[model samples]
Target: MHVKDVMTTRVVRISPDNSVRQAARMMFDNNVSGVPVVDDQGQLVGIISEGDLIRRTELCSGTPSPADTGLAPDEIAAAYVKRCSWRVGDAMTPDPVSIDEDASVTRAARIMHERGIKRLPVLRNGELVGIISRWDLLQAVLSARQDDLPAGDDAIRRSVLARLGDNTGLEGLNVTATVSDGIVHLWGNVETAGCRRAARLLAENVRGVRGVVEHFPDPYPR
Candidate 1:
């Protein structure tokens, strides 16, 4: 599978100048843990997460230091709060590691692992196309399993489950597939509208998927 096959294209974005509080609100409202920081032209510049915002609060600072590191929580909080006052451009990881849409899902997974990151922005023709998270990789892997196994009509059902587990980390996606001559009928609730789209795309990408009967609900069950 390709990175584009599982990325969330309709991204939630915030301006660099947006306050940490505002960013947090956006994340909460959208039920997203992070938002891409973008410029006026919607160019992806960085990313901000709940951890970044929480780090700025005096009361919500880090844990108590170990004996080896003699640092007060307040001291760490003070520094973080100070940086939070600046625009995201000053604090966010500038020039984030990104992947091309055509890149394989395995490559995307490798990049995330190497960077110790959960997400990666997808680029196409030098422009932002989408973003893929570790969840996406998981879903892709699940989808690949169904194609690898050969079985009866019930085979597609297990295939869909595998797809759900692999392509997305969303565990509750209820999958029911009816395979007749390798044609798949898919039904399920995915984590997000993006995930629903990804599920269908992966089904199509799989070999012997004659057609997909999609009944995936948007804004999947939490």
Candidate 2:
């Protein structure tokens, strides 16, 4: 699926000229952790999030000095501005990462994971069309339909064997499966208890599977 399929069209935005207090209130009232900062022409300029606001001087007792942080004078000054600035423009994260509306949901998720971000502003032709968050991706997962599997004991056995061989952690192990009356019987020389359990689960999850029986030799044989 694509990002546009799950993105939220109603985005709560804030102006760069808005006060820090206003930005905080907007987030609180909207029940959001961040707001996209826009310019007079409705162009996305930056983003202010709870992470940015938590560093404000009002929330802290004191700011760290350059000597304590071992940071350069300019770096310390920039951090000071982020912590003490009144305008959202100076405090917000500039040139924030964004995703195209037509991009795949997998790509969007990868970007968010790599950047350690919770949301991305979905843009169309360099203009903000909507926003996609981790929550939205989760909703898509919850609504997705499971792949239809073929019925019958033979199909179930094939599926179980294929699953075991297809990166199910039982790969390379001497595992075999037989199905009768929709019940699967797994046999193999799996050394680890985890792999044995994995084989059982792999068979149990296949469609038309009613029960799973393991016939592997005990690891702690006397």
Candidate 3:
């Protein structure tokens, strides 16, 4: 499914000029971890999240001095602004990662996994159209329809044999099957007990299959 198919169109946004306190309150009230930071023209500028808010001066006891960490003067100054700044523009993370609205759900999930992020802003033509979260992907999985399996004894027998020959580890193992009244009889020259078990399972999982009976020569026959 495409990201547009599952993404949330009703996104809560924040302005860069807004107070940091406002951003925090918005997140709390909306039950969201973050919100996209937009500019005057409604262009996405950055994003403010719980991670960013946690670094604020109000939450910490004190800021580490540059001399203690041996940080460059500019780096220390930037860190100070992030911790003490009141404006969301100064505290939010800039140039946040985003995904296109037309992108596949799989791509969105992959990007989230690789970046260790929980959500992504969905854009279209440089405009924020929606947002996709890990929860949306999970909902998609739960709502997806199950595939219709083959019906009837003949069809089930065909499916089992086809699966066994198609990269099912039993390929070219002299395996074969027949069906009678939804019951399957597996006949083959499987070398290992595992192979015999695999054949039985393959047949059992086929649609319309009621039971499986294996008819194979014992490898340990003396």
Question: Candidate 1: minimum summed lDDT over ten consecutive residues — where?
Answer: 59-68
Q: Which residue pairs in candidate 2 collide?
A: none
Q: Tens-digit lDDT track for model 1 on 55-139?
A: 5534445343233255577765555544546466554555778899999988898788888888888887767778899887887
In angstroms, give how far residue 107 of model 3 lies from its true place: 0.3
Give TM per candidate.
0.55, 0.67, 0.67
Residue 124 alpha-carbon offset, candidate 2, angstroms: 1.2
Q: On a 0 to 100 scale, what is the lDDT of residue 29 in model 3?
A: 97
Task: Order candidates by TM-score, high to low.
Answer: 2, 3, 1
Error of 3 at 91 (Å): 0.6
What lDDT tens digits, residue by residue, belong to model 2 across residues 1-222?
Answer: 899999999999999989999999999999999999988877788999999898787888557644438887798878888879899999999999999999999899989998999999998887888999999999987886666564799988888877776567887678998899998998887878789878878887787889998898888889
lDDT agreement of model 3 with the native? 0.88
**What is the per-residue lDDT of model 3 for residues 1-222, given as tens digits with 9 covering 90 to 100?**
899999999999999999999999999999999999988777888999999988788988557644437787798888888889899999999999999998999899989999999999998987888999999999998886546577788998899988886456888778888899999999887879788888888898777889998889878889
Which 10 successive residues of model 2 have the least lDDT summed? 59-68
Model 1 residue 64 lDDT?
32
Q: What is the lDDT of residue 112 in candidate 2?
A: 94
